[model samples]
Target: MSYNSRTIDLILKAQEPNQKQFTTFQQFFKSNNPPPLLFEKNITPKNVKAQRSFSNKTQDSIKETKRKSLSQLKYPEYRMLKIYARIKPGECQLNYDKQSILIETNPYNFDRVFEQSATQGDIFDIVAKQTVDDFLNNINGCLIAYGQTGSGKTFTMFGESSNPGIVLRTFTHLFSRNQETIYVSILEIYKDHVYDLVSGVQDLKLKEDLQLGFYVDGLKKIKVDKLESCQELLQIAEENRHVAETKLNALSSRSHLILTIQMGKTKLHLVDLAGSEKVNKTGAIGETLQEAKKINYSLSCLGHVIQCLSQGQDHIPYRDSKLTKLLMDSLQADCRTSIIVTLSPESKNQDETVSSLKFAQRARFIKKEIRIATQKKTYRDLELEITQLKQELLETKQRMSQTSSVSQFQCRYTTDSEIPCTESLRLTYRSMTNENKENYLPNLKTQENNTQLELENKINQILVELQGLNKEQSLDNVKRQVAKINELTIDMKKTYKVLVSTQGLNNNQLQIQSQFIETQQEQNKQLQKIAEQISSMDSSKPSFNIAINNMIKNLQQQQKQNIEDMQSKLEKVYYDIKKNTTVQDYNLNHLALKLVASPNRQQQQQQQQQIKRSQSKTNINPSVKYLKNKK
Candidate 1:
């Protein structure tokens, strides 16, 4: 039959009411048989209930991996933070409509909203009481306050003069509760530099150890067994804190301050972060601008770390800033942290308020893996450990000695002369026994003496070489000293030459002055002689008298001219000496002043001697009298 005719007949027969059964041989050719199936198919049952069941299991697995339950742990666990909003007084207010908008913001939600009337005590009671209790119970806890500039963040965390804040209240409570040893360490991170507030170390470092997770390397820890002591330390630290005047806040903190209180193994960290101020809004410039940028950068790094933790990200960059690095242990997966977000009611601070709220919101999702700090071993415990270790060591030694092969193989020592051969050493060691220890000891002593002698000989040789080196060094030192002496001698010779030149100049000046003085005396004597001659002439010779008067006038004119010429000569000599002194590389200005004030001590003495001689030779007054008498 044709393939098309057989297929059409089979289809038509299958549609009939009663189809006859075909025999095995005719089944293939029967026209009433249904068409042959092209391929076999396996059908799966569609059960919506079973599919939903599998989908739920897959979701549960994902959820379990995403976040494990902390409730199952026996140790203390960290709780998610709830927001607390307190609008500061005397500040701008958010409008009713804006308030509604802010409340509607999903991430800006808070557990408690306090109006402008909330007190410091109320805020502390709500935020810090539980943390205090946890701290007392030997659990580490942290309470941090964050907000905008001039939002009263420090005032709220530390309080003003009249109002006491959480820190004081916590101190009072701890003191009242019992006598506990409290160690306080206060530090600040300013402009990316870590500083100790209590110790005044401007630049400090952070160190991490296996036991203490992260600590400031050179931070000062003060032990305060009394409340007064705690107060004193707090006051000192506050005095040391870095504060600056900003346009936004009068006493604006320029750094992040962290105060850690340790009681035995438990600790409590109270951090007050510098307010978040915008560069433009705060009107920050220069140093203030730089500080603002660093503060913002560190806060941003902190925010990034929190965001990563909230979203279950693998990597958290804690090493981005010094503040975050120091706070690594407090912000890690094993800390109990609480953040108090302080806000300003001012509409101008709306952006900062929103930022702070969002920061606290992200922090709410962080579930730190909490565990108690390991306690240090006591004296008794240490002593027990030492005893146990000693016993174990003895046991090990005895076992080693029992195993002859092991002992012999491991036992090896070197002698002064012999080459180090392990096989020979082992043979020698095995040959010695307890009974022969006497003989072995003597041989060991002899070998030790030989080694000592060799060492002594080597040391003597080294000493001799060192002595030779020292002698050579001494000779070199002597040569250096001689060279230095020669250099000093040359300098002294130059100085002496300058002195000789100055003396010669002074002597020339003195000689010139003496000569001028002598000339003046001679002129006086000649004037006396002329006057006497003029007076002695008879009045009858009127012409002769007039001629004599003319002669006297000429002589006086010559004396005036001679004095002027001497003055000119003195000025020339002075200028020449100045130029020569300068060329000789001496300080001529000072020397010139000295010369003008008093030419020279020796020159003055010579001038006085010359004046005495002139006075003795020509008594000018007596000569004038004698000439008048003769006339």
Candidate 2:
């Protein structure tokens, strides 16, 4: 048999099923008297063209199916799917506008579509601002970024360079609008293992709390004061995140990163999912391959959950995967959610892009039952706030009183004619006091010092009684003490007001009056100190109460004596003024007597006793005349 060169080549290239066929081919090729073989034409130009056309049509059909699968999704019409087309590596053509992406014959519709050229600011305004607003209104919100490996999921959620991403912007807006404390926690889920990125807790467990829902056990939650603080933490978490090199991406995150922002009762979850990728394409090996499988499985479980939620299925497989379990609370029907599905425009990543779109579509059908978290303030917090405000008010009032007193004193001395005091008498008294400081200062000082000792003894007795009262720790006793303190404070204020009104004296009288005023101020200070200590007392620390009680009782007794002594001195001065009508200013004397006569009932009882004893020694008719003239 003779064989053509083409036939021989075909026979050599084709594998033989049996040894007989191979032996026959070898014998035919070696023989010179080979059979003449006519070569059969297996391929024609027309057939080749037809096959190429079939291949083209089949690809078109596949592309059309992918487009229709996303576009023809029968999800809930109330919520729109937000899709962003990220320019993948080696992508040349931009098939996306600001609103939608064109995929062959069908357009993948979205609420808003961001192209490769879109800025972080643009994305923040379109997507994040609304979420921040919802958060401000106490709405439970979840914003998630999902895509394939190297699809810019992290960059979208947390941007690079100076352009801030959604999480930072949300914090900035939240703090700017409301100055409430913001709490933050960062964690990553890998291979069904949860780890704290902030505190470096390894193998953190997911715990289902009845009150807090699903939370990572032992996760470190930090109280953030400013946007810069949160940004710093985010950087730290990024450094601590589980990431490694892969065939698909040089620095691919191997775990799902969940950033939770707690604002009072409302919680905002910014989740950046590990991009779904093909195990074969990623070329993962050993532990990397295992992690990739876990990532893919958890992500697939999330999709299944979304589908079940969209279909209103009862048996939604939330507990099937750790990722889904963590998201179960945030993805509920009542939560406000937004999913940013990143895509690649490159033809090479078409498969991943289609899969991501399908997942995003499934998420869009889920009807989130939008609910705002109800914030409730505990009784203790409210009580603390009230106490804080009261302290502030008291301090402010003290400051105002000091300022007003200084202003009044300056006004009285600067223009003596406007007040009841004669300017010459004032100068004379100023000179006398300056010269005779040793005489006046020491005498009053010694008296005040001695009064302090006696007052201290009485205060010690009061404190012993107070200690006994406090030992009961009964609410009724606390209420009674508070009421008693309030009554005492009111009486002190009244006495101080009466003393303040008795101003406008000559220089000599002013010196005496200032000494009295100084004594009253000291008493007021003691009262304030005691009141503050009582107000700030903590029931848990009984030692503080006993110490404050012991320290202030003597001061309280001294203040009571000082007030009585001041009234007595005022009455004596009035009698002296009545005896000496030769004094410079009759108006001053009249004003002083009128102020002394009009004391509150607490002072009246003491004054009445002093009046009966003084009636025989001094005629009251002149003082009564001074009071009537003043009126």
Candidate 3:
């Protein structure tokens, strides 16, 4: 068949889906058909975009990776004091760039500058977290915040309960990140004398050890295994910390607080330096004036040390101030230190701000070399650790004893069958403590047998007393007599409860008590019905009628009170039905998120059988305080 070129193309298109072979007129009759090209140069398809090459994509990815690497903080190979500055908010204007702050014309640079708006957590993430992380890798580190009065140095280092500062965060971070036993020593320098904040030892002397540098002699070093222990120490430190009010700032830290945390071989020193203040501007007098002078001189001494370190002077003056003396090792060039320079943004305090900047800028020049602090554990630390272990073992044994007692009690007493039977009563008697079984079980058995009879007798006596009321007696006298009888029944109930709680009644006694309560309720209802019947029969006699009416009202009130009391007791029994169920899961949920979740009951049993773990080493009730603080 003959066809046009368009028709031949159409014939090929029509057969594209069927995949059947077809002899086209073009292939069949054409002289020659050229082969398709293998490759084309820059020939764009109709309505199509060009694809990017793999090399270009790789180049773009490499650029992004480089950008991220530049921004991210890497653990420094050489340990040096890194200076970071933070600006305090005020009415006056202060200029700043990415890592530098300006005081009018003079420009000062730092490793990084945090604006006043940065949160406590933000500061911790960029500053303390890295130190803690590296400390775990066995690097000794020190962090200090230095600034003038009312410059937010204390606030940055030690914040409110709701907003935890860096020190608190560091404690928690170290505990969470490490399994090693940590030793914490807290102290403060108040007016040129050192005082142990933890033990409240006044005028503690600083001593230099061959292995340990600048150790505080007789400074109580406590082993803190948990954050709560650290918190308790911090709380004690805060209470003992010398603080006073001034015109410049209220509750100014009068003493420089230093917290030394020992993790394995490495020690992290967290220092909250006392505010550097000008006595003239702060309006100080007497002791406050003396304190200011001492603080300024000590800080000046520290500045001198920093200046020498920055200038690479060989004759380093370490004994200039007691503050510097205590921090001799931490101030060494090998120590990995981070200095947070807090500044006042107020234009009025421009000079103090400039001075703080100068201190930090000098710190930037002091190079850090890695120091290996592989000191052996002390005798005191080992003794404390041993004492803690013993206490823990005792607690564990106590818990195991309680759990065993509870389990045995449940297995013996908790049954689906009825407990009122004589055989079951005998079983309960057998389950009692040896002393109770010998002394009290027989009396309980006797009471159990006679309980129904006694209830019956009381009911009969009540009816007889009501029916045989003396006609000659005054109404008041009869009412008083009736009240006395009701009081007797209440006394019996009180006695029964005392026996149940004090003597540790068996399930037999409890079940009997439960029955007694039920029977008593029924008896009250029956007594009410009897009173109604008697009142209905004797409505004709006016005097007797009035007495009976009062009697009925009294009886009703007593009945209601008795019913409520019985109901409360029964509800208490009901509440305690699930007592054997472990509440650790719920209790753990009530605690802070940092607390470890309770192990499975089976796992606990296995652990109790195996290694017999030690109890908590610290005295801080972290769960209680954390929840309280959170609330």
**Model 2: lowest-lDDT 10 consecutive positions:** 35-44
List ranges where model 1 is wrong by over 4 Å.
Answer: 1-82, 91-107, 370-631
Residue-wise lDDT of candidate 1 within 350-466, one digit each (tens)?
778778878877876776664543343443444554465455445444433433442232334233223122232223333334454344534443443454454455445444444
TM-score of each: 0.47, 0.47, 0.48
- Taking all chains together, the TM-score of candidate 2 against the true structure is 0.47
lDDT of 3 by residue, 1-631 (tens): 3445654455344223233233432354243432112112111111011112322344455554553343243444654678898887657578887589977687899888998788899899987888887666666789999998888878888889999889999988887866567899989999999999888999988888777767788988799888888899899999999999998899899989899988656778999999998888989999999999999999999999999988999987888888888777788844578999988888888888888888988888887664443333344444554465455445434433432333243344344232223333444354444554455434543544454454455445444444334231334444454455455444445534533453356675577587655656555565556545554453325666676667657666766576456545544542353253235422322222212112255653443332212113223233333333533
Ranking by lDDT: 3, 2, 1
Best of the candidates, TM-score: 3
Q: Which tens-of-lDDT digit does each residue in 208-325 have in candidate 2?
A: 9766777788889899988789889998999999999999779899999999998766788899999898988899999999999999999999999989988878899999988898
Say which candidate scores most in lDDT.
Answer: 3
lDDT of 1 at 55: 37
How good is model 3 by TM-score? Answer: 0.48
